[model samples]
Target: MACTQMNCSKNGTTSAADLTDDLIIEILSLLPVKSVCRFKCVSRLWYLLISQHRKRLPQTISGFFYPKHRYNNEDGLIGFPTFDGISGDQKQLFPDSSLPFLTGYRQILPKDCCNGLIFCLCWKDSPIDEADYVVCNPATEEWVVLPDAGHKSDALAYRLGFDGAMSPHFHVFQILEGDEDYGYISGVNIYSSETGVWSYKENGWGDNEIQIVDMRGVFFNGMMHLLTCEFKILAVDTEGKTWRTISLLETMCVGNICLGPLAFIGQSQGRLYFINMRDNDSSKLSVWILEDYNGNEWIFKYSISTSQLFGKLFGEKDHMLQRDYADLLLQRDYALVAIHPECNLIFFVWRCKDVLLSYDMDRGKVCVICSLKYHLYDTFPPYLPYVPSFLRIGKPRVEA
Candidate 1:
């Protein structure tokens, strides 16, 4: 008689040979990026499925990458972990995790995240004349330091592009500011991981004075979007090598970014968003989405009332929602960071109060995510939406 069960209980459990391909893919898709990476070692079939699952399902924001604080003496890439609640509607923050990178000679500053890769700038200690521009996939712990592109500007910005399903490779775009015969010109430089080289596109910013007002760049519609100090939207097409400038709605508050980089632009569910917190009316905040990109139309989405969202913070003594509470949010010490792409969640950090808060747009609930004690300066910790993936750059490019 054959044995009913194998005697492998003492060693370990058996493999999931009974699971079908469709079922395996579905289960792996819901897991976190870190777990997916570890499961690759389970079996060859699981590894293949986890590697290609991004093409089967939609990708959402994983978490955020930032330093502890800008003014603080500590140095390195840091992680602000996010969690999923049992109720599905609730989310919470976990303990901070520091990213592994060299500490002494080089200081890493997290910049942009495209697809699932993060772009960081590594500054040298001694001379400090040139900085190392590096790109990394935090989930897989894969990083590469880019070669010198020969452009030296402190106000430069970066964007990464990759189509994991169509191609196993990715590229980086660097937007640079230069003075020309006419005026300031923003140039574009593209670095291909496959070729291991950088290509330049001169005069990328035609006639427009591209201001480096925002610290991060929004990647959407095959282009990189950034806000200028002049209140105009500056876009650079990575594929077409073109530039376009769209005017913001004409208002007294336009171009007045006195509250630092609080006024931000982000992309959610393929729709471009512009959060206008620069308004003097601090009680209500406005959100704009790019309804018609070709027509340069920005439609009003919604307005959130701070009086209702943060009323409890003021306490029962100040029961009558005072208008000054809104003013407090508008101060330069406050900022609006990441906006969830799939939902109405917004992340805000109040440096003066030393706290990070998340506001749910649908439920109208505000939750304190964490304390800013570790990240305390005016511009200490820079926040960027983090997405985890198993993509490996510099691999052979596949045909679409």
Candidate 2:
């Protein structure tokens, strides 16, 4: 194949030696991930150059992978997974959203995603105790099924902890429910990829009586942060050695007349963020950030009103209309899907409207991303934020 104008040398020879290392990287960064992967075979230098600069390349959060409402025998999963591409042509990255690469398991449910890998619960049949925790990279189609931790049935939540920049190994923290108590947590079972083992530890949060309001936990800065029933963020390290508690906004702690505040905890731009709808006013939504991680201080960053979100304000005179809207909003059908890992944006889904939307925190603008496929049987499905990475699993780290 002939070289393009950008790659051709001055003398008309299509030689890579004609370009500087920086120039080659600049050109490679413009291509898709698959194309960049293929170029590694050209030479040893190209392989090293691409491998070292992989993080600096144009990798992005292609979309989200959520459970499809319907089931198919051919797919061999209880909830057939589907992807919704919100940016670029990256949807082509996953030709079969069903994830057929995972063999042997009749059912696979994605529980959480960190960096680029997905944490899933796999089962051969109906029993929950005979389950395996699998971590797989959708981009590379590489998966590793974890050994049974012996307390799969008692698990309340499974959170994946991984930072490719920090280390090649990953950890899975399984929050175990209390033996006698229903809402209380007993301890955590920690799994490490490096040792290929599962270690158990008693609750490290002291005597706080931890009760997670939501099963989903945010993995950031070597710690897994979970929102508690007390409206506070509880964080624990992957080693299960250190534990810390960060309080939510004072106003958010107050109880509500309706179905409690629609709150979610997430990480973006290397900082922890908490977003929620105001309890007193259903129309108002606020975003808080931990400006200083060590200080545990939360600074109110931005707020959006229903008028700004929906594009029209409701007047008090329309009492019936306002009441209906409030009821719909507080019915626990809406969810803050994800906080953009790289930007001042949030993606959420409104089940009542069957629409997925993005709110820009910087510009205070709301944009409809796409219309969701409404399923009557499905409640609020978890939308895991996914940024595809071509990193291979169970491989030695190639240091840049």
Q: Poorest 10 consecutive residues of model 2 by lDDT?
A: 252-261
What alpha-carbon RMSD in Å does predicted model 1 have with respect to the real structure? 8.9
Clashes of 1: 1
lDDT of 2: 0.74
lDDT of 2 by residue, 310-342 (tens): 543234566566555654564354577788877
Across 134-245, the per-residue lDDT of candidate 1 in tens digits comes to 7777666677778777777433667777645455566787766675442244577877787777788775556555555645677676666767767777877655367878
Clashing pairs in 2: none
Clashes of each: 1, 0
Predicted model with the maximum TM-score: 2
How high is each candidate's TM-score? Answer: 0.72, 0.78
- Top candidate on lDDT is 2
Q: Candidate 1 at 209: error in angstroms? A: 2.8
When superposed on Cα atoms, how far off is each prediction in RMSD? Answer: 8.9, 7.9
